[model samples]
Target: MRLSARSQRLLSLVALLLALLSALLGGWGYVNDSAAVLLAAPLPLLIVLAFVFGLSQPDADD
Candidate 1:
């Protein structure tokens, strides 16, 4: 589904927050020696990259 500009921004913000959370989780897992953090890390990094890139583009309406 296509999101409106406001929705796109909101989604991007949420993605940013999730990315931070994932990083935190990775750090915590590292201290605890959990293997799952490795898998969890890249996906959110990629997602944050995508959302930031998408948000950086000029608005179609502008």
Candidate 2:
């Protein structure tokens, strides 16, 4: 798949936010001693993967 540079940048930003949210969730879970929130680890990982894929794609014009 190919994506324009602008779209790739946007996706990367979103992915960064997802990772931040995941970290926050883990912190909250730690504070409250809950394992459930920490279980959401895979979600951010998936987002990061998507970000990597987006970066790997060529621009539409290329």
Best by lDDT: 2
TM-score of model 1 (CA atoms): 0.44
Off by over 4 Å in 1: 29-62
Q: Write the per-residue lDDT of candidate 1 for residues 1-62, one digit (tens) a residue.
A: 34567766666676666556667767776534254454445666657655676668777799
Local distance difference test, candidate 2: 0.64
Q: What RMSD does model 1 have?
A: 4.8
- Could you say which candidate leads in TM-score? 2
Candidate 2 collision pairs: none
Q: Find the 10 residues in a row with the least total lDDT in model 2.
A: 31-40
For each candidate, the alpha-carbon lDDT, in order, equals: 0.62, 0.64
